[model samples]
Target: MKSQEVIFVGTRSGLRLVLDAEENIENLKRVLERRLQEAVGFYSGARVTVETRGAVVAPEWIEEVRSVLAHHGLSMDERGWDGASAGSADGGASAGREPEAPPDGAGQDQSLPGADTVLIRRSLRSGQSVSFDGNIVVMGDVNPGSEVCAAGDIVVFGALRGVAYAGANGSADARVIALRLTPTQLRIADKITRSPDDEVQAPSGPEMAYLRDGAIVIEPWTTHLGAVFGV
Candidate 1:
């Protein structure tokens, strides 16, 4: 399977899946499965538009591709390559459902990584950087000099001593949360703040940062804060 045979492309609207129309259906299935498995749950609950580069595709072959994508928790856009709703080989129309975003005003729990969310299982070292179109969850620490930027929210299960920018896409509602929130710098949307002059100390509990009156505010994360964040 060539790398170009199964490609995942990111766009302003969302993710796109480009397939080689000339490739064997079985081969495409195998390659697509392998690629989706590599990302695992990262792309789950996401809808993707399929592109075949103007090549005509057979219904059975397309069904095979759709099955593979479904196995990985992805749905094909109803308006596919030709920008029109398409039916299945059996002449049945399959509705494409967009992934649901977190409820308005409520912060999504980091435990349940959702659509467009990237889960990093390992700690980031100095000079490391991560940029994503959606939410970012670090299972481990983000060391000093590292950087993380997300279009949505940013969550660190362990210490966060590095730089973090949430709402990179200009979403003022986005937030940043960490178990130990002593970052070199933090930014939520257009608001930015740096560590205090005081020496960095361990936090009593997890902390969260969000925009307030056009400024960034850091506070201890509490269970009842759902009123502030919705969830």
Candidate 2:
């Protein structure tokens, strides 16, 4: 396979593997393994989707790719099975379905066994993105057009104006917290929501967004709420 045989694009949903059309199956595996090995630890725990350059990808080939991804601790997203492209080479949105209502007080404890927490000390600019297997804590703003995704919760000490996806691995209990809660889009697990289109009042204080009654809801972050996320 050539160097351009496989392309990796990060988006609000997760990571996408855009494969070239007419790629030799064996060569495809080799390139995929090599690329994944190069970023070994960084890609673990991220949900992945595969897309071809307008070619019909066989199920067996997809499963082979899935096996390779699993070896690297990544799982495949089924949405791409129908050959729907998640994003272009630059990356964009591929929204998931809204989740059913979760039980009361779900995800309140917000603890994950053996899940590592990554701290990003710098703000994320447009066209930048970060994805992790566990939780994420960003010390600065997430500017518009940027994205932050984790399999667990996300806590931003500054503004979140871009896209933020918590529980990217299907954990509906995950929450997103920011000093300024506005965002282009917000996703928790399989559920998705966005900021209202109408003008809104300024954020009075820190805010938290989470799944409630099968929809995403935002509330003021209080002193007690800090204990829930262990901030």
Candidate 3:
């Protein structure tokens, strides 16, 4: 089995995925499919960048690779091609280039009706803070001392060790979901809760926190509650 690793390359648009050059294309596709399967909710409507670090390749190969990604509803942006000369046969100098930003107000938000969902693909280290007006879905861990606040729900694919506040704008229906729910402080709407000092050590699993009666209550996530919770 091939171990999948994620490398972040910060850019103007957003973070880019740096795929290993040595890995075969099949393995790359498999890794991407697995990641999508694991975090379907996070990637449902997210835009991603698939970056490379070599000269531009054949157009057919690029199209084929892109088709594979499209099957999973993932968009791709090619970048990092500085080796080929201007007149090289590798399809001109603009083969693998970053896309220019859209014109002002072309794609900007305009009082959208649906709530925005921010998908974070990297870990939140100590001292890092994320604040958004809508829901937040983090695909990585939230380390201690970090803070995440959203006006809607909060979903952490990994461990939650920091402080998280869902429904910060007073939406009592918002909830917090995490794979490992041992947070220093957790809040839903106006209710707040903290992990007990003598916390019981147990296997980590999916859990959810929501407002119950007048207080926040945590419970294990189950598929059977899908209809009741409207999840």
- TM of each candidate vs. truth: 0.52, 0.56, 0.51
* Tens-place lDDT digits, model 1, residues 144-210: 9999988688999999999998876456777899999999999876577999988866788999999
| TM-score of structure candidate 2 | 0.56
Mark the regions of model 3 whose C-alpha exceeds 4 Å error after superposition: 1-114
In candidate 2, residue 91 scores what lDDT?
22
Put the candidates in TM-score order, highest first.
2, 1, 3
TM-score of 1: 0.52
Give the clashing pairs for model 3. none
User: Which pairs of residues clash in candidate 1, taking residues 3 or more apart in a chain or in different chains?
Assistant: 105-229, 106-231
| lDDT for residue 192 in candidate 3, whole number 0-100 | 79
lDDT of 2 at 33: 93
lDDT of each: 0.73, 0.75, 0.63
> What are the RMSD figures for all models against the true structure?
11.0, 13.1, 15.5
Which portions of model 2 show Cα errors greater than 4 Å? 1-114, 227-231
Candidate 3 on 1-231: residue-level lDDT in tens? Answer: 646443333222332455554466677667766765774433332234544433344566456556765776655544322222222344232323432332122224422211689999999999998977678999999999998887678999999899998776456778888889889999765577987888578535888889989698888877765458887
Model 1 residue runs over 4 Å out of place are: 1-114
